[model samples]
Target chain A: MKNGAVLTVNDLRVYYDTPAGTVKAVDGVSFDLRPGERLGLVGESGSGKSTMALALMRMHKPPARIAGGEVLLDGVGDVMELDDEGLRRIRLDRLALVPQGAMNSLNPVMRVRDQLADGIRTHEPGDDRDALTARIRAQLARVGLDADVGGKFPHELSGGMKQRVAIAIGTSLSPSVIIADEPTSALDVVVQRQVMETLRSVQEEIGASVLIVGHDMGLMAQIADRMGVMYAGKLVELAPVHDLFTNPQHPYTRLLIESVPTLMAKRALASIPGAPPTLINVPPGCPFHPRCPSAFEPCDSEVPLPTSQNGRVVSCHLYPGEAA
Target chain B: MTAFLEMTNVSKVFSAGIIRRQHTVAVDDVTMTIDEQSPSILAVAGESGSGKTTLARLLLGVIPPSSGEVIYRGQSVDDLSREQRRTYLREIQPIFQDPFESYNPFYKVDHVLTVPAQKFQLAATKQETTRLIHEALDMVGLQPAETLGRFPHQLSGGQRQRVMVARAMLLRPRLIVADEPVSMVDASLRATILESIRRMKQELGISVVYITHDLTTAYQIADNILVMYKGSVVEAGSVEQVIRDPKHPYTQLLVSSIPQPDPSLPWGAEGEIAGDPESMEVAAVGCKFVDRCPVAFAPCAGQRPPLYHEHPSRAAACFRYDDAPTLEGENLDLVFERQLASQPASGSEEQAAN
Candidate 1:
């Protein structure tokens, strides 16, 4: 909290209480979010990136339960310890989440302006209505939306615009930390850039730490200050953006980097051989062991301890005997 | 010197809305050739509604072009008879963008692989179908037994995409129309899907028409590149020439628009303002990219540029390179001034309307 780390999650585990069995969606994940910093949480589907993001906001439904660990917000106590009312206050005023498929996140029946006003009214009851309207308009403009767009219905705006509006509404409360889950996945290249730029600008304007959960490494590299590479249900590598891309230590991280098609590089990309393990029945050893090219005997039997290498923490057997 | 597939002035128009009054031009006057012996991957690179998907659909003969024709093996795709169409389908196949949507979520992953074998009668028995499915799965780096029983939802995006590729390969098609095939897969798994297709081209001598907006992947896999902007081929050439040494203003803009993985480079310095979405629906004259084109000249407003041959392998539809008489120096500047004046005062309004 002293270092502008707005949110600190340690050994956080979230599992789905499904009828079949408990699905370990997120397991033993630890990370810190510095104020105004952008952290890109990257992994394929079922790697538990989305689940972890949802768990941070404490927004999971009945079937999903936070199994263990702590999520600390600056100036606020443990998130899990908070009662329903305490969580509600934190949700609207301190933490905002831009969920996945934001195209549908908006209230389809409500006008865009009314939606923003509704959020403001619900969160800040005593705030002046005129002031709220003006603020919403300004926020919309900040995200590159027209002031008139507030009057239009959700279906009236394009996918990119709808997403921008969602961002505008999400940041209206001026939260300390914002979690955006795959915000630009459905957007085309040009629109994708615009949406990403909006997110970057919004974060800058509000000075909020942004956690972007996505699978696009190239896009993540463009915006993220630091990145945490998740595989299966575990965090494999966490490093500064440049270090993660250029000098990855984890076998899984290397595979991720190598798999990205770069403009300058011409070598045949080596796609990691196997699929991500099922979260319900994860492999016993390193979650990524089945797909790791350099995996050996210990990799399949014992979970690799997280070790620090060149300013980055990588959980891999490759970085054995290093400082944890 | 016969081309494997040649698209001559192909255009596709779709009617939208309840009354079906709106005409959406998906592919517009796009003409290119894929040579038989060249063994090169042709990238049809553009964003959604840039007509890349329509062009892919046209090539696959899944949908007939509204105008013009696609020639396959020196025969027109539109004119193919029943048996000929079947042969054409055998020669050309498609790899869809969303692997999850490509298969029935309820069915097992191997079901997609076995369908083509059964359709083409490549496997007369269950055992042969099983064997072929295993071989195809192995080629895509999947263990047959492991993938055989898994549902689409159970597998990751990467695995499902590979299964789609394997299904395409089962037909042993000479050409593949991959429409943003890896866009949905994870960045870590994209190279694998791309490599599988590249391997198909190399090992089986299949030509690939890769449609994508990602220049990075296009640079890696495409031997030749075609940059489409608003239903037109703005530039077409060898991948190195088009990507490294682009000629058209549109092509240059697109190549530069790609954010490099390097963090040192400041973001948005090379960024192009998003195009007016309404412009796609308009019946544009001159150049479709005139509004966004930095180097657009006067002739770019009044008259459309033809695809001018620069080198034997390269062609571009830009007044700067074309031999059109109206494209003189001062005139270009005058045209640029007029266009700037004619553009809507509020750029954001254009986006809002869309």
Candidate 2:
């Protein structure tokens, strides 16, 4: 792992083996997660944002496999090289995942308290029932739920409540890195705001680095300190949230930022001219060049590596510099 | 002037539970209208379970209202004769949220367009039908050559939705009831879909009732806005008035909750938290939003607040607007007329000439 980073991903590539060919879902993505920092990954449906989140926690199922990458954790060794027992040992205690679809994440038959206790018991089996109960109450309280909520089943909770319970379970052991995949996708804006608030507060209390993955740029701008834009399975631009919104560098990033409608102003939304290329067989050179407005000669023939200058990293021919 | 379509005191109640038969008011007493002479977009903005879909169903005559009438050209929809009903279906089209579900996987994409043309007898022969299909597809900005021979699964979500827009355009409907058209689409593609819908108003001079939970898109494209909450119209006015300066407490909560793309202006500190979803059971006697409303007072708990006409062009169903006169039967139409008149023309007249 890097000196001060909590998690360092190097050349991470996750691919799905289909009948036709290998679908490169997460292609050559690299980034570092600072402790207590919130980094958000924004992308469209087929952009591989969710796939990267699952692959980071090594939770991707069959057909989807991590091709080659180094997911190095602080104190812990390389996550990609970890065996079954080693991966299981470090999963919830050192790293956790709050998956998508909170409505279906929890067990329907189990009580909220029991679902929480399962994670705790798996890690620390020696804890007594009273201690577990106390810990469960504290976890529920931290997520702004009442102690009585522990006895209720998953079906009894609302969409926002289910998400809160999911967060409580994820942060129960105080993991160093927490990956939240579209934690507020199905929620209404009002409930979304409340749930995000709860997630942020709980993350702060635990001092865990959050890697939130979603498509909503507005929601990402609110919660994420640093933002990464993904297109065609590649991390095209990574910059601080403010700079990314204010002065987006990559053409795709700029188009995405301009596409979002705002309440304060009304302007013609800049729709990207073309759709994202299929990842099954990505076009050579830059994947975003086809849709990019300022497509030069090099953009069609040569891939622009991530160029870092002034704490901003953008992959585009317009910014010529040493690759990060 | 006669309205193109109007819902007068419309309310729909669904009785669930076979044994107990609990009646859920899916859509409460609400009245809105679209003028035939002036083509515009009316965005019905609200959260889930806010009766946005039920309202769309009511507009499209997919479901019958329990109390009031859906009047089309001064005639009740329920009392329309067979020929009039057929004409009504041909004139008022619907664009649903999920484009994938709307298509049959077994048939080619052309099947969606061709079947409607045959049903409505839009063209006399197959050659004329194909020509009409090509023209419709071109209207929505899809290349007919690329989209015609493909199945629903072959096209991208954005393309499928545009095809659906093209399908809606084939009949040349006077009003298009688009229920959350872009909710299931990708963020990058949302603008294109919305742009096509806007073009329906501009190029074709068709009025649209765009139902969605997204306020930003509503603000971007809609001329007038109706903010729904718990099956009731909490606020209704020009999009500029309702979104920029919300009157109802629930509308304020909704507006504030929307996270702007700009990071400099972060969301404000959490105010009064919304009540839990289980506590969202509607009260039959009082304001539906009273339980979650931050400014709820004594009057809010007594009787349902009427749509108080706060301005010539705006109305909100809240006690905060108690100083304004309560809108009676014909006042809603008057206020809506003013609302439409206040906005600049959306270029529909010039484009309609083309």
Candidate 3:
């Protein structure tokens, strides 16, 4: 049972303090990532997948706080226990994040090389200008960018090129873990494919563990080794990419898979009835029970904890027992 | 014979910039028609800068085409009187990309439904307006109780989008130009919106000009799909024919790029680089796609290839066809593998350390 993954998150709970009530953005979520493995978290907009990723990085401020959880990176210790200096060092050296859009990440005014150099200079303060430039050029190459791209402003580059620069910036320090938040969602389909491909090769090249957050299951199928389904601020199911797509156990997961239309086939899309429940005052019992098809008496009363089944896990009453 | 809706050699150019002005050719010389006999869905699909958005505006008569004429009912759109223009605008409704923008944040959700019903005279009195609103909500499968009186902020994106579709439906427009209507909605709820659009065409007998960048959704509802790239349409045919076997290299890339939810098919890194689609000079003589095309030979850089009819229902614009324009240079083999296409642009990638 001990896979010895580099990062293990257990009982992670992130809640926002709203005037109305506490919004449980990420409640009772747990997952582990092997050192060079890719993990994908897919959910609808308000499913709290992005909040969970932000929580993983301990980026919660006053409004949003990690109420209870333990984020244990193999050598970095519990992220919750980290103080100001620890958080800073760990964030810069141990973890890197590629935010929602690459366009948002880069400083439009600064040269691409300078921006990357800024990343290295913060961590490796002793490195000279030439050394930083060399490192920046090297990182650019790692993300399949040209050396000349160093001098150009962010506006001069295409969206895909800007995205590559974002990747390079994220991976510049050779961080152990990289969290990509919907890297390709804003792009054209063709460009989206190309950006995803770059991320894949870069993941392979650097051998860094990746935790990607996006709503596109089709994209996850291509990018991740394992996939997790998040709904109503809960991690509903976790399985290998192929297994999750082929044999989704949870009713919500099953319906979620059916809802997405794939290019390979044009089977009828069964739209999941109703929108996602609000995290602030989620429905009692199962958050998904209101929209769940196989809602029995139990599903409407008691919350289902994630139960392991067939080398994977799902949080639903359907799979109540342990794996056979 | 006059077609029901005709766009004859339509082209739109914009000259912008202050110090250094640059002309942008958003739509090239494109001719298309939707027949009156068959009320089928015409999907104009392409990536950004493909001019699908401009074409939608032109169709809606929001902007006049720089050269071409848009004819409706055997009359030029330009020649239509002010009264006729209003009627034309009502008949050819448009569904914008963002649903939230369609409705004002200040107004109640049902207010959008009321204005259209009242303006178009679908209802006589207050009671009749409410009835029409309820009926419109029913058509799009929205509960009137839950949707009515709620502000735009309260309604979910899918619900807001549905309300927009319902609003457009109440008018009973002959043709609806839905430009990326489902793009903002969640994936789980996308089918419902697409289904609603399909039902409008099939059950209501309204034609649709569905403009989108997503091809799978296009395939699901579109009767005819038009593939556009860099301000020009490269391929046009039935969904089954064009998607099954794409003739143009750009169409092939767009088709192959669709991320089908299958783990077996790996995301290949090497693909065509869609280089600055916006920066391509407006006056360039050669094929616009030659820059990113995988099978670009000598002749492709000289002249634009005419649209070659591959079948009665399908056509493609490429030099690979047998009816290619004669050139001084020899015509090479028309073969382009996606993997090889990515190579031409990447020029010796720098090696990464372990």
| TM-score for chain A, candidates 1 onward in order | 0.96, 0.98, 0.96
The runs of at least 3 residues in candidate 2 whose Cα sits more than 4 Å from the true structure, single-residue gaps closed, are B337-354
Best by TM-score: 2
Tell me the tens digit of each residue's lDDT in model 2 across B110-129.
89999889999888888988
Clashes of each: 0, 0, 0
What is candidate 3's CA lDDT for residue A60?
57
Provide per-model DockQ scores: 0.55, 0.76, 0.58
Clashing pairs in 3: none
In candidate 2 chain A, where is summed lDDT lowest over 10 consecutive residues? A267-276
lDDT (Cα, tens digit) per residue for candidate 3, span A1-324: 137788989899999999999999999998898889899999999999998888888875669898898989878779888898888887847888888888877888999988888868878899877877778878888787889999999999888888889888888877889999999888988778767878878878878899999998889998898999999889999999999988889888899888887666666667998888878879999999999889999988899988886669899988787731
Q: Candidate 3 DockQ category?
A: medium
| lDDT pick, better of 1 and 2 | 2
lDDT by residue for model 1 over B210-240, one digit each (tens)? 9998877888988777888777777777777
TM-score of chain B of each: 0.85, 0.93, 0.87
Model 2, C-alpha of B205: deviation from truth (Å) = 1.1
| Number of the top-ranking candidate, with DockQ as the measure | 2
